[model samples]
Target: MMSVAPSELESPETRLAPDTPWVCLVWNDPINLMSYVTYVFMQYFGYSREKAESLMWDVHTKGRAVVNTGGREQMERDATAMHEYGLWATVQKDD
Candidate 1:
């Protein structure tokens, strides 16, 4: 077996690539009402009713919506917030 150098171990800072943006995605599901979805969007995101309704409609018709975009931690928080509101949500790195 070969000996490994201590430098080969990566720090947390080194593990993350710089400038990667993450997005929060809300998925369409049969359980939640469209109006409620819009309400949740407005409540959580502080979006105007019109904007929230638009996003809700997009998820209703298109099957998903990119609700928010930011750093990974922010996206994760948004996803968790959506879950708290009973919406199916996820986070992914923005391409």
Candidate 2:
């Protein structure tokens, strides 16, 4: 690989900023039970029982809930983990 001179490298101050915040949304589905949803939130994100239950209620009654918020990569990971746990999930840039 060709080596670049120090001047050719992007300086920290000139580099692009870190990625914008993103969110993982868990959608309501008939397959998973409410208790299981709460458990998934608590287990995966280490959310408190009350917080998990509140999010679960939002998913149940509102059709979806923002389960996580962070950088795009982390939000994607959260969505994938939710999928692995058999929950419907998606990631999007937070408004």
Candidate 3:
């Protein structure tokens, strides 16, 4: 039997790495219309009409879409903005 000391388990691998990219995800909701979601993407992200439509469709069928990616603070801000726009949104670390 091998026994490990407690100190051996607390390695640098457990620390939170800096500059890790995060993502803002928009989830599908029953209240918001597809047109409104598309419009929000276009208006908020400045995406092209076709691009916004495509992302909106992705969210509709897939249940969620990665709308933005950056630092955790930026993702949080983006999720807040989506909330203000009446969309279901959340910030998460990118895998």
Candidate 4:
């Protein structure tokens, strides 16, 4: 194994600033039920029933919702978890 220096790594020009925010977007898809989506939101995020339901509604009506936000790594984890739960999700840098 070889050790690589951080300075040798290439960061893309579009890379986010050090503290730039990221978000996990949950998209409405035909497969998952609305009740299941809301339950996932509550289970994964620890959101209250009302909050989870509200976000679920936004996803259903808007076709998507910003389910969570934080550092890039956190958003990535959240998106992955959503996928594991059979939900459509993506992580993106907040604009």
lDDT winner, 2 or 3 = 2
Global lDDT of model 3: 0.92
As a whole number from 0 to 100, the lDDT of residue 56 in candidate 1 is 96
Clashes of each: 0, 0, 0, 0
Please give the lDDT score at residue 66 for candidate 4. Answer: 99
lDDT per residue as tens, model 4, 16-88:
5356889999999988998999999999999999999999999999999999989999999999999999999
Q: State the lDDT of candidate 3 residue by residue for 10-64, as single tens digits.
A: 6777655556789999999889999999999999999999999999999999999
Tens digit of lDDT per residue, candidate 2, span 1-95?
99999877777765666457899999999889999999999999999999999999999999999999898899899999999999999999888
Instruction: Please report the TM-score between candidate 3 and the true structure.
Output: 0.80
Candidate 1: 10-residue stretch with minimal lDDT = 9-18
Pairs with backbone N, CA or C atoms under 3 Å apart (clashes), candidate 3: none
lDDT for every model?
A: 0.93, 0.93, 0.92, 0.92
Off by over 4 Å in 4: 1-18
- lDDT, residue 55, candidate 2: 99
Model 1: residues >4 Å from true position, as ranges? 1-18
- Write down the TM-score of every candidate: 0.80, 0.80, 0.80, 0.81
